[model samples]
Target: MDPSSVIWIFFVFLFFYPQVLFRYRLLQRYKFIKQFEAVRKTRAIVMIHRQEQLALFGIPLYKYITIEDSEEILRAIRMTPEDMPIDLILHTPGGLVLASEQIAIALKEHKAKTTVIIPHYAMSGGSLIALAADEIIIDKNAVMGPVDPQIGQYPAASIINAINTKYTDELDDETLILGDIARKAIVQVKEFVYDILKDKMGEEKAKYLSETLSTGKWTHDYPLTINKLKDLGIEVNTELPNIVYELFDLYRQPVNQRPSVQYVPVPYKRGTKK
Candidate 1:
């Protein structure tokens, strides 16, 4: 090839390189999303919690379920046809109870079958949402935790117990007030869990599981593995399909920083004076 032609081809390739790379990455992301939906035979929604990171302005960003997340989930449900099933891909340490309940209600009310896939651990409020699903699928290593409500950092049951151990005269006004609130919260959470489970299991079994899970029989972070859930009469699948693992792999966070290439303009030099 002629030197001029070679130079022209090099410049043209350089001009379009970044655009080509960007389009390729976009296509890859689209393919992964579509593949997950296709394999599951349902509309897939992912709720993964990323590690906390600092934003561009140095503000801390948390990746827990929030009210905004519930709004987005509702929006997605609205966009999907009523007859279409949904598969929720959950990978969270759980978050706000109110937010989780909002999602759980939406999922329960969805016209089609709903399934929750726990790729790793879905604990606390996350378990509440999973209870709304028709079926729960988890990897062998995946776990669900007790749904005992927490007020600030204190477990509701613990607060109530502390009050019970003290005489009425020994309790201060504030302690009595907090104990009352905690007792009410415990009842509310147990009732919510019972309602969610009643349709899945019979009312009797649902009531049993709900009380057991919400009354702090186990620590808040206790892992309910697939076998344990099965023993509790919950419909749980231990063997995850290959496609589920593929989706999990797609959602896995990278341990290392992403590499980037940036263009730096060459400094222009003036001829030195002799």
Candidate 2:
């Protein structure tokens, strides 16, 4: 072959390889989702996010639940039959309160049973959505987090408390304004949480949970373990299906940087040697 032709062929291969690989992975995900739906007889919706490298720039971009996510999820729920169950595969570090609440409310209003499956942690708004589920299936070691409202870079409860401690004359106008907004935000979120949980658990237990989770009892990022959640009277089960773990494998994070953790990717039986 001529030198020019060889170079052109190599460039064409490089250009098409990543696109082909990405399409193949997407197909694999859809296949597994269909399999899971067939086995469980439910509409399976995935809301997972990972830090992915952008094409060309290779810049890592983190994803969170957004308005767009809510729109799509809501549509998926609507398309499901009234009696069909819904299985939401959730994995996120939380996101916008409006988007999360929208999704949570939609799930809560669904006529059929709604299940939230957390293979890992679902913090902030993610936890809010999980609370709306009729059943929560999580990995034993996975976690949920507080739903305390945050205002800008500060916690809403903290802002209100801090303002209350200070003399009116000593606080700036912006501080006073922020405090007012913070109080409203906290009240709004607490009420929303209570509304979602009241029917699932009793009103009294729901009130306690709403207060504990939304009133800044802990930091927004605090991990609520399976035991802690159970202790708090939230009945979350640790019966994550094997297919969920397998599906998570397909949503791998971008490999633009050195991976922090490594392991032998195989199962071991105690009695049988490899």
Candidate 3:
């Protein structure tokens, strides 16, 4: 190896070896094990940051809801030694509904109260999990989405292109394939929308919400804001979840900043009247 390359490697190992060990958690394994035992003994709130894990073409796939580097969490969940009050802090754009539902059922079955704290956003399938929680705490501006499952083709621009092709240039047999695909895409979108109807708001409303969101009913829009969750009876408030307490209060915090608490009509206190 070149002498410069060898020297660089030595400096890298010296400077970054500790960080590598920490990231992999090799250095603190024993200490963490002991602390894990202690935390399990007390009724401490369990904090899990389920950020993006799965994506498709830059879009968050619902299936990424699975826990990664979550053996500690899995162990904690399985530790039935004592009852520990838990709070799940979720900030997701929504992925797979079932993955979220499992976490919801697990939290609800174990603790006395499983409050889902939406520090920033809990949308799509994430919203479904929030619905399962006993209490949902979110800032007034904190968003939760339409629960109206989106089932549609992306870039509806493709459909537009196909139409233009047929009109502008003489479309051949492949155009026939596009015709069939576009038709089926519409039907697939409808079927998915219909299925979601059966799950939420009963058959009638699910059907309506699905159809409404899919078609031009509500106007095809993305990035629906926090205001809509307010309309859905979710108590949007400025209350802080327990995780935020530790983030600002404790030393060596991981997250950059606490979510901005937005004031809304919903009451943050336990007994306050709406």
Candidate 4:
């Protein structure tokens, strides 16, 4: 072939290869999910967000739970039979309160058993949705964070603290306003958390969990380990299904993206050094 023809063919392969691979992966994921549903006899739903570059712009975008996510999840829940169980695989850093609450409330109202499996971490709003589940299945190393409300970039509790620590006259008008809104946000989220947990556990335990998770005692990104959760009477199961890890593998990081962490893909025995 002429050099010009060869160059054209290479460009075509580069452009078409990714598209073909993406479609194949999508189909494979669908098949795997269907098989999982069949084995578990439940409706399988996944809410995962990864930092990926846009196709046209190639600019990396961070993802969080959005209203669109809630809409789709709610629709899936509605389509499921009332008697069918739901398996929600959540991997998120968290998102909009309204969106998260919408999803949590719908899951709470589901007639069948609801299970949330966290293969890695489900922080903030993600943790809120987990509270509504009948069971939380998480990897032993996985973490969940406080559901404390964040006013803009600041934590609600911190905003309130700033106002209280300094006199009203010392604070800026906007700071004072944020403080007031922060207090209200805390109460609203605490109540919502209680509502989701009340029926699952008794009212007392529910209240405790609600306050602990939503009152902003810890930083927004504070990691709540399985042990800590269990200590708080969360009854979290650490026996995460192998298929869940497999499913997560399908939602891999974008191609051509560099990974910061790398290690041999094998389990190492204790006291064995590489």
Candidate 5:
């Protein structure tokens, strides 16, 4: 074929071979270096969801293992240069707390100077994991939610039901039982948040945050912002370097414009009983 004709054919081929286009995009991401190239070398990412909703802004991703697997986590640690610093990126709405906790603890225990980076929202159980990191970096637009642990969404609803019923129809034995469950849940969640804060902040501040967090009103309390974190004595680095800030703002554009800088989800089974 003539050179001009060959170019035309190549364009048509690429139009038909979309997977090639996708592979090309993946190739770009494979060697993708953040503006702060040094930081990307030792970074880990994790993402999460309750069910099959992996798409943030309708970007096609995965349902299960949407974040890093255990092996991947180890790989990130191992691949990181021994002398370089490391950062763990988390974008989770608080999945299995135990799983989140394990990841958080592992990141914490790693020998490298570790930092937790929250580019968007990390709430509930996810916040617990963020607490384990030595330092936490929350972008100006990013937020870490209150770590008020609960027994999933149903039991909490059931307890609320019992309270409403008790108020409407006076006390029944069943209502009283439900009341007990609700109270226990409140206390347990309170304690859980407290314990998490204790590790990140200290005992006194953890107690305060725990009580404030359980109200269900402050699950994603970003308004408190860095002030609240400071109150807890949780060290937060909110002011990013100007260049890093520029890169972060660029990376946060819609998925089409920005590659997924999200957690590589790992295969994780949700609790059947939960």
Candidate 6:
């Protein structure tokens, strides 16, 4: 071939190579987005606190529920039609009290039935959210936990009890103030729990369960098994649906891997740069 013809061919390859690569990346992203939308359309809302999804600099994110998370959940609820049933998949160590309450209330107020599926554990605030569900489905090995409120890192009940035991001279202003706040928090949390349970269980039964869960009788992190929950008048299903396990499988992470950034290319418009 002529040298000029060879040079023209090379220029064309250089011009089109990046465009080809960009299109391939765009196609992959489009496929992933479609799959995600399909899953959302299934009416399953998952709140799994997986280490991979929540880790930052080796620290676990969402050790407590956040206000931002409540907003995201609200958005998801908005996307769901009022007549559609909601299936909530919960696996978390729990988080902020107010944040949890927001999500719990939203779930409770949903027009259609809401079912909570616990494949493993839903502790603390997670338990609070579970209480709002119309039905709870759990595996035999799954656990729910006490709904006692925690102020900062200290359990509210413990803080109040400590104040009662300690002499006035031994307690500083900060300690006294915290104890007062904890006392009020304990009452507030019990009220919230009662409200969450009142519609499913009667008011009296809800009150009893709320008192039992919030007074720290079994400790804050006490794991309530299926039998215990049944005794408490909660309708607990020992058999978890296959879809719950499949969801967990999708979110599972490999052991010993650090969190990393992920990038997906956006499809370019026809008139956009290569």
User: Which number leads on lDDT?
Assistant: 2
Off by over 4 Å in 4: 53-60, 255-274
Q: Write out the backbone clash pairs for model 5.
A: 45-263, 46-263, 65-265, 65-266, 65-267, 66-264, 66-265, 67-264, 67-265, 67-266
For all predictions, the C-alpha RMSD in Å is 13.9, 8.5, 10.6, 9.1, 8.8, 9.7
Per-residue alpha-carbon lDDT of candidate 4 for residues 1-274, written as tens digits (9 for 90 to 100): 8999999999999988887877676666777777777677777888887788887798988889888888888877877767778899899999999999998999999888999989999999999999889999999999999999999999999888878888778888888888889999999999999988888799999999999999988999999998889888888999888888887898784744322111122332323321
- Give residue 3's error in model 2 in angstroms: 3.6
Better of 4 and 6 by TM-score: 4
TM-score of model 3 (CA atoms): 0.49
lDDT of 3 by residue, 140-258 (tens): 56666544433344323345445665564566766556556655644554455455335434677656555544333332334445566555334445576444534322212232221
Off by over 4 Å in 2: 53-59, 253-274
After best superposition, candidate 1 residue 129: deviation in angstroms? 0.7
Instruction: State the displacement of the C-alpha of residue 163, model 1, in Å, after optimal TM-score superposition.
Output: 1.3
Per-prediction TM-score to the true structure, in the order listed: 0.78, 0.88, 0.49, 0.89, 0.60, 0.75
Clashes of 4: 0
Q: Which stretches of candidate 3 lie over 4 Å from their true place?
A: 1-11, 14-63, 67-75, 80-83, 150-227, 241-274
Give the range where candidate 3 is weakest over 10 consecutive residues by summed lDDT: 258-267
Whole-model Cα lDDT per candidate?
A: 0.76, 0.85, 0.47, 0.84, 0.56, 0.74
**Which of 3 and 6 is the better model by lDDT?**
6
- The deviation in Å at residue 110 for candidate 5 is 2.4
2 against 5, candidate with superior lDDT: 2
True-vs-predicted CA distance for residue 63, candidate 6, Å:
4.2
lDDT for each residue of candidate 6 in 133-189, tens digit (9 for 90 to 100) = 888889998899998888888899999888999898999999999999998998999
lDDT per residue for candidate 2 within 114-157, as digits (tens), equals 99999999999999999999999999999999999999989998
